[model samples]
Target: MQRAQRNSLRLLQWMMAASLALPVALFVIAATISYTSTNDIADREIERTLDVAHEHALKVFETIDRSLAELNEVVRNLSDDTIRAREPALHRRLKRLTDSLPQLKSAWIFDADGKALVNSLASPPPALSFTDRDYFYSHIDQSIGTFIGMPLTPRPPYQGARFFSVSRRRDSDDGNFIGVIQASVLPEYFESFYARIGSDPGSFFAMGRADGAVLAHFPRLNHDLRLDPGGPVGQQIAGQPERGLMTIAWPSDGIERRIGYRRIAEYPIYVSAGLETSAIRARWFATMGQHLVFGIPATALLFLLLAFAFRRTQHLQAEAAARREAEDALKHSQRLEALGQLTGGVAHDFNNLLTVIRASVDLLNRPQLTEERRQRYITAIADAVARAAKLTSQLLAFARRQTLKPEVFDVGQRMQSLHDMLATLLGPAIEIVTRLSAEPCLVNADAGQFETALINMATNARDAMQGKGRVIFEVETATTIPDTPAPVSGNQGFVRVTVRDTGIGIPAARLGRIFEPFFTTKQVGHGTGLGLSQVFGFARQSGGEVTVTSEVGQGSTFSLYLPRVPPDLRSQRLAPNTAPAVAGSGMSVLVVEDNIELANFAADGLTELGYNITLVDNATDALAELIVDANRFDVVLSDVVMPGMTGLDLAQAVRDRGIGVPVVLTTGYSQALSQDGAAGFDLVQKPYSIEELSRVLHRAARLRRVRDGAAE
Candidate 1:
């Protein structure tokens, strides 16, 4: 009997191992599979990214190549000053080219002895030397095709300046080396273009020569052009494959990178899109994290299930059954609580958003609305829609693709605009106080986000005071980091905003977690716990920081720090929104949207603007329309989120098929878009007005022209 009992126990133990560890092992395998699959997908994405970088690089190279070809044509028109009347036309053309392509720094002609004949520079050089230049030496045979040269820093009036020139060898009728037409490109343009590519933090995209000269990189701000082709980067890419993926560490900052590199077929250059291994690993682990949450519990449950199934021998037994049950119950309770919290937030915020939108709609329907009042109503409606979309996006945890539109704005003016809005939002019980800077605090930030941050701070203050105490809002200028007990910077100035509330102050320990998501001191159902988190994130993302101070009984002060740009150096990017809209004038528009109401809205909008519309349900249909007769449409306007295929896929399809129609993608909130973001296609965020749409369409048409003209 004793031997039989021992055999049964051993059998049960093996059964338990098979039940529990099998699932666990399967989970590990599944996770590994997921990681590998995700990596492959990421590599595919890297290919798209490489293509984009390649396109941007090609724009410059093609521009220079085309300019050289045209310069040759103009020289043919010249014929040794007998047709010198065309000289003025040639200079005008070069100037126009410079204007059209910002990257084309200067275009000039040289004599046989390497003396300047004509220059596109504002202050033209009377004479210039190319005797020592590679572009000159390489083209000594006076070849026709374009020749690229190593970067050079010329001396004199343009001192300490560096540029790369693409030159075409000009020759005599006898095929003797005469001179060259060179178009110098400012490398800074690469940095500018790269910045606009909008790669994530710590990720970099670069365009360089196959020999590994880094033309430009992002977050590499305001530095003199640096070029070293013989460096490590050069050694890795120089004379490398036409396309490849490699692991490398840049000497500038020794961060390991998985680089996706492709050599441009049109030019002797390569483009690299690098994502750090840490980021990739983070994404992989995050996927595994989700699986583990469900996988471990399921595995343990299997163990319990197997034990219960084989109860006859009393063979299988759960050692920590009680403990595990409690843990499972706790996890279940936590998940329910989280679900309830999320649902409540969605319900409450949606109600508020709906109320705002409904009110705006009612106002917009006013019969006797003045033009000014009509504009205000329209603006209000757009704002409400944007707010509603943002709230919904937050519920879905979708990231926003649109960046902060930082511009110089007077804080005093903004405060005046907010006064009435705050008064209404905070209600009657809270006493409002504004202590603004006397010398008009000018700040650089997304005006809308800044306003939202202020309102959030005010809302928190009102809540803390239980709607019955004073809430003080102050804006001041500071030359140091705010409230940091330690020195963090070397006198970097900030436009500081402080929100002080007279309320039940926070405890010493709990103060540390105030900004954490879903952490709130308020009673259940009263708070979504994301208010302060938004403010904190916005501040940090705007190249600033936030700090807080509280005494148990003395109330709390939340201070937000935003970097201050010097008045003289502030970017002049704030264009007036009064540009006259161009009527479509029977121009054909293709509308691709899944939402019937949104499609109708777009169709009606274009119709009002005097355009013909062809509506499609999804990307597939849109592609079909384009494939059938792409020239039938001037622009394709599509919603991002659709059933069959997304707007991004459609835009990509349009490009892939080599269709020449300009595509405009519009979106409210899409997780896919928030992550991968808009490809080179123009993106007009939801809640845009007819005027905004017009502007983007105009811009898109211009871009299409530039792209097609380049192709030709």
Candidate 2:
């Protein structure tokens, strides 16, 4: 019996050691995998940053080169005396070009003697000599296509700004070098762009000459720092001369970083992007910390449970029941707490929002308010109205029931227009970068909703980042969506608008339900959780899709995919209507609405527009009037939802009774409109301006008149 007991004790010891070893081994493997993945992601991000810089540099250089070529073509055969004589015309041309391209600060034409003949900076030309300028000297002896020189800060009489010169060697008909034509490129342009793309602690973007002269750097250095000719990056550029990546300690700060460098095509310029190695490792550690937080506790709990079972085997059944009971009670308490928090969160947000309008109204009611204060109160009321409207629109959008008037528009062009607006809305603290595709991204979507969706995403990004970060809008054409299970049909292409933000990202466990209305990860009263749902619904209603990808501490990317409108269909749209006469000239109209105030308002508004109006409270009475004499009214206007019969049903009955008067419908929200969509009739959304209503009604009336005339 003693021997048996000793053996059992030894077996239990071995079991405990195996259980502990398994968890430790699994954890080690997980950590290794996590570290490798984190580094790989960081490397890709660095490469992408390099690509952006490279593309930007290439575009700017190409523009400068083209401008130079144009100048050469004009002056290659003209003598120095003729060019000098025509300096006035040339200066105007240069000014126009500079004005057209924001990248250029100025343009200049220098003679063989290195004397400036024409420039965009001043009316005629500054009494400046280019003999000592690097751009002029570099091209004097070489047949280079374009010589991009180092950055220089100009002296007095010129703007105290830094810019780099891009020049080409001007040659005569006989291939003899004559002079140099150069454009001054604003370094602030590139620096501003760099600031938008990356905003991390040790992020850097640098452009330099092949000979290691620094042209520009973002997070601009106080003093110039050139790349070492013998350094890893410089040596690679010297050898390969196209593109490369390396890890090295920066000479300026001795900080180790992973850098990616690329040469602008056939130009002696290079753009390099670097991210600190320590930053990358810190990100890795953050990821590992999350894992450890969950894993260590879980493993300890399992071990404790196993030891308890071994020590108290005889009492295991009773303890198991007690443990299960405690878990149930805890889970019940958590559920109640979560529900209460969510309910309170929604109520708190709405109440706070309402206070703005309420306070403004109370202030405006005061008798002795000053004009300035009264105006301020009025402005406050307007702003509150707009916010309330936005909130309602968001909820309606999430419900997929908002009335949408879709039209074919270029998505890229729209994005370009929003650049300024987004910059203003996001404020100075956040940078907005856009990488719009040159190719047309035409989609049939509601323009207003499209803007709203983008704004929602940007606002969410701002919150996630704590109001200060980078938001990048990248638009491109794609045939396949990466996160989808299967590719969309090949015949139909998609315009993918990606909004990427550097923010504390959504947790993986919560990503699946991000589009569920009222489900949010934000703190209480911060959000209603309807923003992403709006995006999801708009994409779906427009026959598109939305997807997202994120890492815990890295950031999130929300991709909105919309179907590209076919070229043939775009061409088939009807021509714009001829500007109609504003005066209704006694054209009769019947208005049907459920609300008495709305009916009277429409009647009064239409009468002002010179249209005679017959108003009714319900569609049933409106139909009786229309059936009496269809020709009495030029058009029938009705609301979609009414007491007995809907406006849509009334229109259908008008047709069934052989009444020929055209019918127009209006609604703030309706299931019929959402599902059937206007039903082959003109529609005007409710709360529409009088101008919009007049135009829509006039169009319908004119169309009816034409139909009657054709029949006659």
Candidate 3:
């Protein structure tokens, strides 16, 4: 009987092992199939999404191009004075042109001095200046048939509002330059077109210039949709468009999305489509859940049968191990919470110091100092400001507050650009080696921030090397693998930027805390402990991931896996220096500032610069003065942040009351204002010197005077 029992027990043990092994084997097979199916679905969905987005984007571009062509034709016809000389014929043609194309807001002609001669929107053509307009200056000398300009805020006779212009030079019968025939397209036209693009709910689209200046958006995501060059998607879009899919984490929803972007063929604009992983995962999860539900019951029955016949000692051991792991995870969470509290406090205090330094530097640029003394003071102030800027940059990097401007460029080229600067920054102790990829591998990132990140990484590497070891910078395109320490996005393809150093390797204990702000291994004064944190923050912010591999005796390698900028977007650079002129003369001005110190400073500066100044403490006071003498203030210069009324409110009120004063808003927190509001008012960023203030005020005054003069 005892021998029989032993035989049964042995047989039961074999059955139990087979049952457990079969379920696990089945599970592995099912998971593999599910993963493969999910990926296939994702691929198909991505392709479809891209196709739809591409089509819609092309449609919008084609419409604009068509509108431009029509305007060009009108300009060509209007160039002949014989045709324009017949007032009734010209008026009828202009009305018919505007009626034929609803998108065309108004058509007009401007002489050499920017005086408006004829306009479709005006009864009797109102006189106006085009000298300050982007379209006027940008395309004034175009030898072509027609030139389309970037969108601008319209002024005079037409009412101040945003509009895109198409201009063509008028020529006499002998081909001598006479004037320009221009057409203005309203913002509403673009808005209507965008609305018809059929975007899904929770999805938005924007059209912007290569420089990140937003031209239009569908359903308008923000009041001002200026693509922050420092923002993740903006940085990614900054690259060439041909390279294909660029995966990034969407900051709005904190979801990993695969973005396929393409730049407009002829224009300096990009169109991108974002596909959420969760959307793809939904189908995969359902398939997996259905498979699991069907298999779980059968597996449970098999387990029960085996359990009845077998010893249960092994099940207890696995449960005990899981419990220990759970406890460890709970402990780690507690530690993270504690560390977060500590970091938050430090960051708050650091910000205050930066603000004070920035303010002090602005105060130092007063005009009272002699040229020699001013230059010396300016140099010192600039140096201090730069250091403070770096500090704020680091803080923003750590906090993920800094926006990214992603662009596509050769890794080698970028590295070469920084070669001398890096060498200077690192000093002679560290030997730098570059192993850049021969094929230009494009990375989508803010060039400035990316350079800063690279410098920070190099600095850390140099420190690790103890000023006497080799620091190698390497670039290569790579594919990621699952079940490995890779970026959280789960993207297969990436551009790897590796910074390896032969130095004192990080200890196991310190490795985990290396990315924590202010968690330094070095002496208190030697470091702020923000370098690695900034690097980590930058990587995460850029829709990429970073990892460090090191050994106690050997050196360390910091690998940054950034999303590759597609091949097509690699050539798109920000619009080259198109700075607006600061010259404006012979104009009356109104300076409204609550701060007596700043107001008086600005007023005195404007008065010296030959501008008639009317100073007020609030927007209401300015409004009262304007109402009493409607034609007194040619330009209203008001503080953005004010006690009684804001600059925006003041400007709106002025417009509402039909007071035609061109508003130039000033603010210390220019960065904080909405882009639309900033664009609406010709803004002068604060902490401005008397000269800087004078220049802006003079320009604003001139523009206002010109507009008012045209009205009269």
Candidate 4:
């Protein structure tokens, strides 16, 4: 009986052991298979990502090569003309073309001695000497198809922005190198779109020379690429095949990563895309987590199953949650980066503007400064202020908060008036083509806003062209009626003004949101991103609309439509252009103001303009003076606001007295300019330029002349 009982116990123990061992063994096999399969998928994903990167990179190279080839052809054609380099038309054409390639900083024709002759940038680039440059010397030393220079800053007068240039040898009939046609490009342009190229965040995207020197790298470590002995992108791929992948530890950051690099065919360069090792393993680990859960039932009978699998199950869930967090993190990071860039750009540009203002101010304060030099500094100050004001105007316009006084005007005529000024705005690199209609395209809009909008569009067009291209300003009449299938902006007679560019077109992905405020395709500081927003606001506010149509590699067109009015509509005459500041001719001027400082300032300015000045602190005081000697003053000038009665009241009182002196009210901002007591009187904005003040006073004086039957 004892022997039989012992046999039963032994058999039970064996069965229990088999049950646990068999299930655990199966679980291990399944886990291994799952991990292997997942890794294979991860490998394929890497390959797809790499190919996408490669294709995108190839497109960039193709664009540059095609552009260069087109330029080369241009040179070949110009070879027959000996003085082509000196031709203004040819220079203009070259400049326009170079500006079109926004990446290119400047385009130039250099003589055999490497003297820069005609440049696409405005007449003869400042500090045009280039013989010292290696790119120039390289062609001089030997013939090369297109030699690219290392990043460099040219010299003084050209501010310190790092640039690289591509040069093609211009040869004589005897095969001796003559002048070269060169285009300088900012290296940042090549790397600017790297983040959008489907490469992983924090991974390196690099363009390298055949000799394993880095040309450009995203997340720029240096304005120029540098060589590091501890290779992240260089030596590891020096002798690699035309295409291959290698893993290395990134020197800048301690992350181990795998890189896929391709040698650019037909060029002595290589491009690479990298991926972090930890990121790769995340997918593999996730696969194991899934297997652990799936294989749990297979080993349920095994009480002693491996502890590590359970830990990973928890880890995998946590990683998934962390991944969700990471996505949010990515979005936050991008926003921060954009904000940082925005602020950085704003500071950079403002600093440069401020530097000019500061230097001008300093020069103005110098005791021994020549009158001519003082005038120059003053002019510089004025220019800087105008530029700053324009910047402010854009901000206000974008916010739709600026006070605008609309007027009836001919759109075609307005564009014509602005033609010369717009040319200066676009520089010599761009062609301003105006197609003004013979028939007047009449519209009622604020002249200031109208000009600003036009400038904004033209500037945008200039940017779209990368600095060079044809910008067309066209004005035509259209009729928009409510309930029409194809309405011309809607329910009114419309005058359409289109600003079109023949430059790089907008991408389809970005087209929809181009009108959004603070959204831009421009590098930080280069644009406020408010330009189009201002256009949108101006159009909508003006009882019309603006529209844009674009395609990649083609160009862009922005059409601004405004409601049209009859030709018979009496247009408000723009303040006529004053022919320089004229002597006041001893014209007696009555100056009234609430502030003592402003009154004195006005007196000084008027006195300098050759006017006899009677300064009063307030309208009440001014009125007392007027009663004492009404006809003694030739014109009445007063500040709009005062402690007693306002300038408007004073003007009305002067009229009540039968005084015929024309009153001009000056204010920075006042609703009273157009209010009850001030109707039909001339108005001048405060902070007026001396020229502006002179012009307004002369107009007032002319008004007196006209009323007296002498005619204004």
Q: Which model scores highest in lDDT?
A: 2
lDDT of 4 by residue, 638-710 (tens): 8887777988888889888887778888875454442232476777755566677887888788767877885
lDDT of 3 by residue, 337-408 (tens): 847855664565456555655665665666576777656656766565555556666666666655344566
Q: Please, what are the lDDT tens digits per residue for candidate 2 over residues 668-694? A: 888778866886888877665566777
> TM-score rank, highest first?
2, 4, 3, 1
Q: Candidate 4 has what TM-score? A: 0.44
**TM-scores vs. true structure, each candidate:** 0.40, 0.47, 0.41, 0.44
> In model 1, where do residues sit more than 4 Å from their true spots?
1-336, 348-387, 393-445, 462-496, 508-530, 540-545, 561-569, 572-583, 620-629, 642-645, 652-660, 672-681, 687-712
CA deviation > 4 Å runs, candidate 2: 1-383, 429-431, 483-490, 518-528, 571-585, 608-610, 655-658, 706-712
Better of 1 and 2 by TM-score: 2
Hey, what RMSD does candidate 3 come out at?
45.8
Per-model lDDT: 0.74, 0.83, 0.68, 0.73
**Model 4 CA lDDT for position 73:** 64
As for lDDT, the candidate ahead, 2 or 3, is: 2
How big is the positional error of residue 506 in model 2, measured in Å on the Cα after superposition?
A: 1.8
